[model samples]
Target: MREEENIIVGISIGDLNGIGSEVVLKMFEDPRMLEFCTPVIFASIKTMSFVKNHFKLETQLHSINALDQIAPNKLNVLNCWKENVSIQFGKEDLKIGEYAIKSLSEATAALKDKTIDVLVTAPINKHNIQSDTFKFPGHTDYLNQELEGNSLMFMVTDTLRVGLLTDHVPVKDVASHITEELITSKIETVYQSLIQDFKISKPKIAVLGINPHTGDNGVIGSEDDTVMRPALQKIKESGKLVFGPYAADSFFGSNNYKSFDAVIASYHDQGLIPFKTLSFGQGVNYTAGLNRVRTSPDHGTAYEIAGKGVADLGSFEEAVFTAITIFKNRTEYNTLTKNSLAVSKRKRFNPKN
Candidate 1:
């Protein structure tokens, strides 16, 4: 088996008008990062140059025309589009959003074709990227559609990990979507991810209640008791380390989320608000349950900080490392489980010796 040190890391340049380039360039600037894996950035040469010069980034932007031309131990930029892209830094433009989609589309193709081992996506604008071909809420939704597998919007840090039971849905619709079946399914996916992807053998998963104070004992709402609690009970009865229906309000503030390996919130904001606050908005967003490994920085496009040369590279760098780690761990796990029979049946032959 090939060592993970040579894993090709695929990157998608997000909104051309945002901090995607700034953080991405910052990640590649570190020479020591190249020792871990080869980076294949799915962005255009023109867009990169504009960001590099605008931010005065000393980082080298090496563009490789094709996959065959990969430069070992160097950050390689793949020209995602045949046409040129004119970047308008910190400005919301449809053209720039389209360019972001172009980068993502090409990177997705490369990932599917095994040109890259894992994908680390930069942030993209959810509004401007809407088009005929792309009709999903965000990266997680789009990836689920493309990969045809269940996906969990999992946010991870050094110690804390959070997963959203209902992702990219409207606030009004969040309650209606949180059914017993879904709560069970989403938490199941989270549990498996914590085990297989992160290599946590006996994962302890906690679920947060939907309403305030866990529906205040059916006063404000009842979804926590009627839906989530039942699902948790069923999952636990089936021999899973699942517990929850805890109030979302005091879950993080009281440090209750730290007790479990991963916490599953009923909705997006419920989980992400506390997660970003604790992790300082530098957590890695991992799309779990898919066959392929994909991760992104927790923060958004950050139009306010675009081209300022001040975008924090911590989250993006962590996302890259997390992707590599998950890919390696999953590969190793699969080898141990799926290929054990083949490996055990064949012993080293020494007839000639």
Candidate 2:
């Protein structure tokens, strides 16, 4: 594992036409941020300089041709593309989307090769980012494929953590998607992530229902009784403290979510609506259950507020800090587990019974 002090955060500059650049520049403007981790932005130095000049930001930049020359305490910009790209604030441009993907792809490569410790991505335009080479709905979907493990869109903050059982799936297909296997796998991912990533020992996870009042004894819908309950029961039998299929309508309103370690919503909006409503600016979209650590601000490409110089730096800063914290937590967890395994092997091979 890399040392705690020298953690390198790989940043993907998302949607140059949106508020991504603004948040990224604003977050690193304060010299104090470098004390936490060295930020290597995966974008052209020229593009970043243009953005800096437009934003009138005083934060300095260090341009590097490769990751090996990354300097400590300086904002490094790795030139992913050298071509001059036009920037139009608040406009959906396919050319800009290509650059966003380029940044993300290189950052992900660095993360996979251990060149960077973690990744904190800025928001991207989901619609414009579709092309022949890249066709992911969002960052989570793309990273899920590139990374080692199953990805869970774990939206998190100090007080709350919400994971989705099925993300980026349409509402009409949501019920058909939430099978017993899907439920089990998603809950297991959440459970393991809590222990390994968040350092929660014995996590209690709650699942929101598919239908109102959990189908109200099959009156509203039969999915809760047939699918969700059985899956939760099987998980419970396996010794995990998993509960729910609670009414999605009143789950957060009643503050019942506070009783659990993390809540797994049935779908995207079911989870995100409450999460954003409660912790919008302060939340981080943490991609949990993957081998590499990655996080992003909960809000997406704010086209309306692009280049306005009024974007909130709260969420972006929170994403950076969250990425660092999770990286350290996972490192410590791996070390402890390895030591435990070694001890177990020694005990098993001992001559004395």
| Each model's lDDT | 0.86, 0.93
Task: Name the lDDT of candidate 2.
Answer: 0.93
TM-score of each: 0.94, 0.98
Clashes of each: 0, 0
For candidate 1, the TM-score is 0.94
* Worst 10-residue lDDT window, candidate 1: 344-353
Candidate 1's displacement at residue 117, Å, is 0.6
Residue pairs that clash (backbone atoms under 3 angstroms), model 2: none
lDDT of 2 by residue, 202-229 (tens): 9999999998789999998899999999
lDDT of 1 by residue, 1-353 (tens): 34787998999999988998888887778788889999988987777877778877777768888987878788898877767677766889988888888888888888888888888999999999999988878999888877756999999997999999898889999999988888878888888888889899999988888998888889998887888788888899999998878888888889888789999988999989999999986799999988889999998999887767788889999999999999999888988887876655554453343
| Angstrom error at residue 308, model 2 | 1.1
Regions of model 1 farther than 4 Å from truth:
341-353
Residue 72 displacement (Å), model 2:
0.8
Candidate 2 vs. truth: CA RMSD? 1.0
